[model samples]
Target: MKIALDAMGGDFAPQAAVDGAVLAAQQLAGKARIVLIGQEDAVRPLLEKHGAAAAELELVPASQIIEMGEHPAKAYQQKQDSSIAVGYRMLHTGEVEAFCSAGNTGAMLVGAMFSVKPVPGVMRPAIANFVPKLHGGLGILLDVGANAECKPEMLEQFGELGSLYAQYVLGIDKPKVGLMNLGEEEGKGTSITQAAHQLLKVNPHIHFIGNIEGRDLFNDKADVIVCDGYTGNVMLKMAESIYDIMADKKMQDPFFDKFNYEAVGGSPILGINDNAIIGHGVSTPLAICNMLLQGYQMAHSGISDQIKNTFKS
Candidate 1:
């Protein structure tokens, strides 16, 4: 299998991306090959710097680049030869099993929709983030920054999407799904949440655990927390801030360390027909490496197929 990465997408691009791809290549040696997509002139020199160590890495030239500040839809449409665009084409053509980029998040989502498209029955594809569990392991949070406003049905689908990821990729069995609300009670949220709760409770696809409060984020109360992008994005940023604060204070706690973005690498765009992950803009080599590994896991787990099958019925 082949895994693709946008070599020029992140702030530390070409160098950090090259270094990360090499690290992932070393770990995934004999298992999968890493494909780097970027401008030839910019990326080749760095790969050459690795000597024979980089010989195994494949470089695909893409002259154009989608800048971070450019409008996602406009940039993606105009920059057809951009690294992100080229990577998506490769993924769509089955040349690569999965694609990872720390570039523009909006562009990644645009590529997913325009290229591989969403699952047959999926209303919308969601951006999923990992949550550190209090007891052990990680939980799934959906719609992190995808659709800031979602309908009741969309929230219901987010639950199913998050459940499939938790079960297939995270290796959790019968993952408990929960609606992130103000209270644990079923009728404690907005009209949308109340309606979504009813829809989720009867959905046989997941083990619905009722509504969950913000404090339950790290607890066993829910393995898959469902919410609109507006709420989930806030939680994700808050966790990131906490991690940064702890690092500044030199706290060094194991649980808090899990909050580091480098640990998970990137956020997977779920409910799409193919696997695609969006990484942080300022990704370091370590973060990029983990993101590639995550792509490999998503591809190997056949999570996309699982989602298609579930939604089809």
Candidate 2:
């Protein structure tokens, strides 16, 4: 499998990305190839500094970079030769199987939508994050920030998207889908959730398990939690803060440590026609390595093709 990395996407830029590529190259040797996209002058020296031969990985030259603070849509349009844009071009043209970036989240989303586009029948592409379960397993949460306002049909589709991701990527069998709401009882949330509940409950494709409250996020009650982007993003940030607070207090626990974003590396933009992984802007070398590995996993698992087939039927 071939995976492309935006070497100039993160705050740390070419250094962190190059080092991470070297790490991934060492571990993924003979399994997959890593392609670094960025200005050749900036990326090549860093590869050598990290004791990685230029021949070990493919280098694709991109003359520009999309800054973290730049407008997502505008930057992507103006900077045609930017690393993010180039990576997406490679992905759309099938030059690479997957593309990942820790750069501007908005730019990544824009490229995903405009480049390879969404799978047919998918209402809106959803971004999924992994939630650590108490029983040493991981749960999937969708619409983590993709769509703040969603219709009932969108939520229903999220259930199917999240279910397929859980089954194919996370190796879960018959994953239970849950709607995030104020109460576990029916008709507890707003008009949207109530309507969404009806749709999901009747959908033959999903194993709907009623509603799941905020407190049940880390428990084993549900394997896939579907919510509007507004609520899901807030929950994801709160979960991230738990790890930050623990690290500040010098607390150490295996379960709590699992909350670190570095462990999961990045979140995949599900329901898109191609594989696109988005990482934190402040991703470190380890996080970058993990992000590349996650992209490779997504491409190798053929989850995108599976979703397309499911939507077609």
Candidate 3:
């Protein structure tokens, strides 16, 4: 398998990206190949500093770097030669099996959707992240900022996607699915959530677990959580912030550190044709390395093939 890395897409670009790539290459020596995409000159020195060689790895030059502050769409369009854009291009063209980027979230999503396109029958690709629950495990949240405004059908589809992810990545035989809402009753949330809840409950492909309130998310209420991008994104950010606040207090919170997006790695952009893991701009070496391994795993996980079969109906 070939994994593409955005060597200059994050705040710690070139250095962090290079270091992470080296780590991944060493860890998965025979399992996968690394392709560093960015300013080769700058990245090459970092590779040497780590006492590693990228001779077997491909260096795809990207003349531009997308700034975190730039508008995602605008940056991707204007900076055609950027690492994010170039890496995505490789993914779309099948030159690489997966593309990993610790760049602007918006830019990364934009590149995946526009560059590689969504899977067949997939209306919109969703961003799914893993959050550790208080019950000593983790829950996967979908549509975490992709489509803020979603129809009931979209939410149901997110449920399907999240289920596949949980089953395959989390090793759950039958992951429980939950709809984010105000209450656990049948008619609890707004029309959208209510409609989504009903649809997911009837969807035989998933193990629907009924409604889950925000307060119950970390209580081990469900293994997979589905919400519209707007709500999911807000919840993800808020949850991360609370954890960070606690960590700042230097509290003995194992959950806060283990489940952090940066620590567990980044979120995957589901429904894309190829493996594309999106990371925050502030990702560090460990986070990037984790994302790199995730890229390798998903690329060969038969996810795209499964999605094709699922959409065939």
Candidate 4:
């Protein structure tokens, strides 16, 4: 298998990306290879700096770049030769098994929609993030920033998508799916959550644990938390802020340390037909390495096929 990375996508650009890819290449030496898509002039030099360690990695030239602040749809359409665009084309053509990028979150999401597209039954692809469980593992949170406002059916699909990811990629068995709401009762939130709760309850694909409050986020209550992108994004940012505060104050714990974004590397765009991940703009070499490893795991676990099979039925 092959994993592709946008060497020009992040704040640190080719240096961090090249360093990360080299690390991932070493770890995935026998299993898979790394493919870097970016401007040859900028990326090739970095790869050369690593000597023989980066020799095995392939570089695909891309002359343009989609800036972080540019409009996602417009930039993606106009910058066809950009690193992100080229990476998506490679993924769509089966030239690579997975594509990962730390630059332009909106561009990554847009590429997922227009390039490889979403699974047939999916209403909209969701950006799913990892949540550290206080007990011992990680949980999945969907619509982290994909669709700010989602229909009831879309929320229902997020549940199914997150559940499948947990089962296949995270190695969770019969993952408990929960709707993120103001309360745990059957009647809670607005019309959207109520309707979604009803749909999830009757849906045979997931193990719906009903509504979950924000307080239950780090608990073992649910392995998959489903919500509209607005709510999920707010919560995610809040969690990150708390981690930053703790870090600044020199307070640390095993569970609290898990809140660092570097630990998870990037968020996976679920419901897309192909494997793609969007990483934080400030990702370090370690974070980039972990993101590529995650891309590999997503492709290898066959999560996309599992989702297609589930929704097809």
lDDT of 1: 0.95
Q: Which pairs of residues clash in candidate 4, taking residues 3 or more apart in a chain or in different chains?
A: none
Give the TM-score comparing model 2 with the true structure, all chains together. Answer: 0.98
Collision pairs in model 3: none
* Candidate 1 lDDT, 136-247, residue by residue in tens: 8999999999999999999999999999999999999999999999988878999999999999999988899999999999999999999999999999999999999999
Instruction: Write candidate 4's Cα lDDT for 1-313 as tens digits.
Output: 9999999989998899999999999999989999999999999888999999988899999999999999999999999999999999999999999999999999999999999999998999999999999998999999998999999999999999999999999999999999999988999999999999999999999999999999999999999999999999999999999999999999999999999998989999999999999999999999999999999999999999999999897
TM-score of 3: 0.95
Q: Tell me the lDDT of model 2 at 111.
A: 98
Q: Which 10-residue window in model 1 sums to the lowest lDDT?
A: 48-57
Error of 2 at 263 (Å): 0.3
What stretches of model 4 exceed 4 Å from their correct place?
none
Give all candidates' CA lDDT scores: 0.95, 0.93, 0.86, 0.95
Candidate 4 or 3, higher lDDT:
4
Question: Could you estimate the TM-score for every candidate?
Answer: 0.99, 0.98, 0.95, 0.99
Q: Cα RMSD (Å) per model?
A: 0.7, 1.0, 1.5, 0.7
lDDT of 3 by residue, 162-189 (tens): 8888887677779999999998899998
